[model samples]
Target: MIRLVLLLLLAAGPALADRPRDPGGSVALRVLEIAALEARGEEKRVAGDCLSACTMYLGLSTACFEPDAVLGFHGPRLAWGLPMTPATFEAVTRTMAAYYPPRIARRFLDDWRHTPRFARVEASRLIARGEARACD
Candidate 1:
């Protein structure tokens, strides 16, 4: 019985891991999560409401998104709504931009990332604008 259960769990693991789920909003954890995904060397689909640190998946080499997926952006700050020092904010922005495609990195730095309010960009629109890739 123990062997059978272990075998079943092993068989189901990859399929389970590949299913997209909402990421709990955490900047450091998101970076670690993306690193793990990249290590797996399989394509990752970004789905559901991707906001906050979830937006960091844009930096992944193997990630794609559905047409209706919500990808939002804002300047990185404390999760508890505390103000970050100007230098810290700039550093965070640069880190996030490193993951984004070049044109997006430019626009995000120049315009939308200055506020806490989410600037939601639909995946379909991003695809249309050549800013993001669509899922197969």
Candidate 2:
């Protein structure tokens, strides 16, 4: 089952860190971390559990202790859930916005804002903050 695959992926790592209280864990963070780990070969067990923890945490539900089960739910959400609630989606978006340049931020936000769940109020605020529209 897909659930089992997710579980194995998450369990492939160690105990995950608490979701950042302020930003919460964002999807982008998970992706970046996964890539970072993969680049480091941490996906392999012999490399230790850091990547596993990162992977597991990335897949976790917003709130839950079970890394495997929690992340199982997150995988699909990652693909389908975009322009989610600013409060909920902020962690990931903010991380990308902060770490990357403004042009990149604008492009990223523009595309993501087009998603169904993107809040108009949030979009307005992001726009006012100089988040350029990719098509602009």
Candidate 3:
């Protein structure tokens, strides 16, 4: 029953893109792209640098990362480094953390979410920690 429903959703979206190969960009665009990929219900493999908003790929149930793939993360920023409301910051932080497993999510919320520098988490470590599976 659920399998049929998932297949129906997959039929509705365009094919998933080739392995999300980019340094990352507009959060809004990535959000839409991720939704489409998630709906497609296909495996997503990450083999290269997926930084910034690109890290959101982890949100998808089918997403996998090659051992060497680098997924970078940092705090949200506004245009011209403008300040967002406290609520907005918290919301964005939670959204990003939501992609990770609970233990890592806590680490992200505690340290990485507000860092000025990007926090790099290797796919190997993610696989070791059971946060993600290795790509075939």
Whole-model lDDT per candidate = 0.79, 0.36, 0.80
Q: How much RMSD separates candidate 1 from the native structure?
A: 10.3
Q: TM per model?
A: 0.75, 0.26, 0.76
The better-scoring model by TM-score among 2 and 3 is 3
Better of 1 and 2 by TM-score: 1
lDDT of 1 by residue, 1-136 (tens): 9999999999999977775657436677788889999999768787767776777778887889898788888778786888789998888788788888787788789986887587788888878987677899
- Using TM-score as the measure, the top candidate is 3
Give the clash count for each candidate: 0, 3, 0
Name the TM-score of candidate 2. Answer: 0.26
What would the per-residue lDDT of candidate 3 be over residues 16-71, giving only the tens digit for each residue? 44344567776778778878888988788887777877787778788888998888
* C-alpha lDDT of residue 49 in model 2: 23
Task: Flag clash pairs in model 2.
Answer: 13-52, 59-71, 60-71
How does candidate 1 fare on TM-score? 0.75
Q: RMSDs, each prediction? A: 10.3, 16.0, 14.1
